[model samples]
Target: MLHIRVITPASRTDEVLRIAADSPAVVNVLKLPGAAFDPEGDLVEFDVAREGANAVLADLKALGLKDTGGISVEQLDLSISTAAEAAEHAAPGDPEDAVVWEELSARTAAEARMTWSYFAFLALAVQIAAIGALLDQPILIVGAMVLGPDFGPVAAMCFGVLQRNVRLIGAAARTLAAGFAVAIAITLACAAVSRLIGWIEPTMLDDRPLTSFIIHPDRWSFVVAVLAGVAGILSMTARKSSALVGVFISVTTVPAAGNIAVAIALAHWNEVGASLVQLGVNLAGMIVAGIATLFIQRLMWSRLGRHDIAPHSPEVAAGQPTSGRVSG
Candidate 1:
C-alpha cells in the first residue's frame, strides 16, 4: 500500500478531495486545512491498496495538483504497519509484495555507480584468474568468477533499457567498458611480469585441461551465461546479495578476459584467440539473458497491476510552484 500526501490551495481543496473520494482503491482520506506554515495549504492524506497505487497515482498526476500545491507518494513499510500480521497472513499473490518500478530503478541506478571498491574487486578477480591459469586449477577460476565486479553495470544496463533511461544506460555502459579495459590491461602487465620471472611457461598453456574453462567455447557456455544473468537480476531486486556471489562463479567472462591477456603476454596466439571467444560468449549471453529476465519480470508485475512511475518527470504537486521545483 502507498500513503499519498497532497497539499493544495484552499480553492482547489474540493476538487482534490473529490478525486481521492472517487478512487476505488482509496481506503481512507483525511483533510487537514492550514496544516503547513510556509506556503500554507490544506493537506490531504490517503491510503490505497498496493494493487491500485499506480492507477491512483496516475489519476492524481493528471489532476495537475503539483502545479498548484505539493504532492508526495511514500510507500508504507509493511514491517511497522499495524496491519502487518494481516498482510503477512495473506496469500502468495499479496498486493503488498508487488514490485514498484520507481523503487527498482532508483535502487538499480544507485547500485550501478562505479566506485573504488568496484575497481578493487575487479583487480582481485583478474589476479584470481591469472593464478588459476598459472596453476591450471578450476577452483581458482571459479574463485576469480566470484570476485568479479562486472555484474553491477551489466544489470544496470538491463534496468536502464527496461526503464528507457538513457543516462543510466550510458553510465552503465561506460563503467562496464572502462572496468574491462582496466582489468585486461592490468592482467596483461601482470602476465608480462610473470613471464619475465619464468612463472608461466608457453607449453603449460597447451597442456592444461582446466585452462580450457576460460578458452573453450561451446553451446553450454551460452546456457550458463543466461542462467547467471537471470540469477544476477533476481539477486539485486530481491536483495538476496549472497546469490550474486554464486552468479559470479557461474560466469567466465572475467576469467576468459584475464586468460586472454595472459596468453597475449606469453605470445600464445591460439590460447588468446580461444579465450577471446569464451569472453565474447559470456558477455553476449549475460546481456541477452539479463534483458530478457527484466522484461519478463516487468510483464509479470504489470499484470499484477504495478505500473512504472516516472520519477524524473517535471510534474509538480498541487499548490506547489511548477517551476524551480525540487524533490526531496
Candidate 2:
C-alpha cells in the first residue's frame, strides 16, 4: 500500500475528495481545509493499494494539484487496518507485481546521478576486483560484484528508454560512461603502481583457473547477462532488495572490467582484448534484456489496470492530463 498526501487549491479540493472517495482501493481518507502554508490550500490524505495507485495518482495529477499545490506519496511498510485489507482485495493485482512508474522514475533518476559517492563506490569496486583478479580469488570477486553499483545506471537507462525520456537517458549514459572511465583509470593506475613495486606480474593474468572466465566471453556470458538484466529490472520495479543482490552476483561486468585494467597495466594485449569483449557482451545483454522486461511490464499493467481505475470526471475526460503523462 501507499500513503498519499495532497495539498490542493480550494477550487479543486472537491474534485480531489471525489477522486479519493471514488477509488475502491483507497481508504482512511482525511482532509484538512486551508491547512497548507506554502502553496496554501486543503491538505488531503489517503491510503491506496499499490495495484490501484497509478490510476488514482493519474486522476489527481489531471486535476492540476501539482501545479496549484502538491502531491506526495510514500510506501506503507505495514498497514494493519481491515479497511486497508479490503482496499488490497479491491485492487486488481498483487502489490509486489505492481509497477508504479513514478516511483521507478524517481528511484532511477537518483541512481543515475554522478555523485561523489557514486564514483567512490565504483572505483573501489574496480580496485577490489583488480586485486581479486591478481590473487585469483573467486570470493573477493564475488565481494566486488556485490559492491559494484553500475547496475543502477544501467537499469535507469533502460527505464529512460521505456519512457522515451531523452534527458534521463543522457544522464544515465553519461553517468555510466564517466563512472566506468573513472573506475578503470583508477584501477589501471593502481595496477601500474603495484607492478612498479613488484606486487603484481603479467603472468598473474595467465594462470587463473577459477577466475579466467572474466576474460573469456562466450554465449554463456551473454545468456547470464540477459538473465541478470531481467532479474535486476524486476527487482527494481518490485522493490525487492534481496532479489537485487542475486542479480548483482549473476553479472560479470565488474570482473571483466577489472581484468581489462590489469591486462592493460601488464601489457597483455590478448587478455585486454578478450576482457573488453566480455565487458561489451555483458553490458549489451543487460541493456537489451532490461528494456524488453520493462516493455512487457508496462504492457501487462496497462492491460490489467485499464478497467480497474475509477471513472474520470468531465474535467479529467476533457484531457487535462491522461494516464502516464507525468514522469515522476
Candidate 3:
C-alpha cells in the first residue's frame, strides 16, 4: 500500500476527487480545501493498494493534475496502520508487470550523479590495489574490489540500455570513464612511490604468479563476470544490499585493473598486457550478464503486475517542491 498526496488547483478539485472516490483500491480519502499556501491549491490524500497504484497514478496524470498542481507518491510503512486488515483485504494480488523503461533509465542516471564521495572511494580503491601489489596478497586484492565504487556506473549503464534512456546512458558512461581514469592514474603514481622506496621491485612482476588473476583471460573469467553482474543488479532492485559483497568477490575488474597499474608502475610490460586483458574480459562478461538479468527480472515482474505502487496526486509537502514528473 502507498500513501498518495494530491494537490490540485481549486478549479480541478472536483475532477481529482471523483477519480479518487471511484478508485476501488483507495480505501480512505481526505480532502483539505484552502490549505495550500504556496501554489495555492487544495490537498487530497488517499491510500491505495499496491496492485492498483500504477493505474490510479496514470489516470490522475491524464487529468493534468500533476502538471498544474502536484502529485507525490510515498511508500508507507505498513506496520503503523490500524486499518491493516482492511488494507490487506482491499489490496489486489500482483497485477501483470510491465517494464517501465523510462523509469529505469531515469533511476540509472540519478544514481550516476553521485556526490564527491565517489571520487574519494575511487582513490581508496587505487591505494588498496597498490597495497595488494606490494604485499603480493590476494586478500588485499579482494578488499580493493569491495572498496571500489565502480559498480555504480557499471550498473547504471546496464539499466540505461534496458530502459533506452540516452541521457542516462551518457551520464553513466561519463562517470564510469572518469572514475576509472582517476583510479588508474592514482594507482600508477602509488606504484612509482613504492618503487622509489624500494618497497616493491619491478622485477617481482616477472616471478609473481598470484598477480596473474588480474591479466589471465579465459572462459571462466567471463563466467565470473556474468555471475557478478546478475548479483549486482539483484542487490540494487531488491532490498538486500549485503548481497553486493558476494558480487565484489565475483568480479576481478577492480583488482585486476589495480594489479595492472601496479605492474605498469614497476615497468613490467608483460604483466601490464596480461592485466589489461583480464580487465577487458571481466568487463565484457559483466555487461552481458547485467543486461540479461535485468531483462529477465522485468519480464517476471510485469507478469506479476507489481508495477502499480503509488497514487497519482500532487501534494506538495512543507518544503518539498514537485518536479511534476515521475522519476524512477
The residue-by-residue lDDT of candidate 1 on 1-328, one tens digit each, is 6788888888878877876665555656889998856457888888765555544555555566656677777866653544433322331244534454545666778657878888778877987887788779988888888888898889888888876779998998888878877888888888888889988877767678767667778999999999999988877766577988999989888888778788888788988888878878888888888889888876775555334343444342232222211011
- Report the number of clashing residue pairs per model: 12, 0, 13
The TM-scores, one per candidate, come to: 0.74, 0.93, 0.79
lDDT of 3 by residue, 1-328 (tens): 6788888898888877876666566767889997877778999888865555655666666667656888877656663565644554554443223333323444566668855888788778767866776677888888888888787788888876776657767888788777777888887887788789987886666655675666677889988888899888877655346888888777877776677678778777887787778877887787788889887876664455443222212232122322222112
Q: In model 3, where do residues sit more than 4 Å from their true spots?
A: 14-28, 48-52, 82-106, 209-211, 305-328
lDDT of each: 0.72, 0.86, 0.69
Taking every candidate in turn, the Cα RMSD to the unseen true structure, in Å, is: 6.3, 3.9, 6.1
Candidate 2: where are CA atoms >4 Å away? 307-328
Order the candidate numbers by TM-score, best to worst: 2, 3, 1
Which candidate should be chosen as best, given TM-score against the real structure? 2
Q: Looking at model 1, which ten-residue stretch has the lowest summed lDDT?
A: 319-328
Model 2, range 1-328, lDDT digits (tens) per residue?
Answer: 9999999988999998988887788999999998999988889999988887877887887787767889999999999999999888887778899887668878999988999999999898888999999999999899999999999999989988887778888999999989888999999999999999999999888798989889889999999999999999999989999999998888888888888899899999998889889889999999999999999987787777442222233444464655431111
Measured by lDDT, the strongest candidate is 2
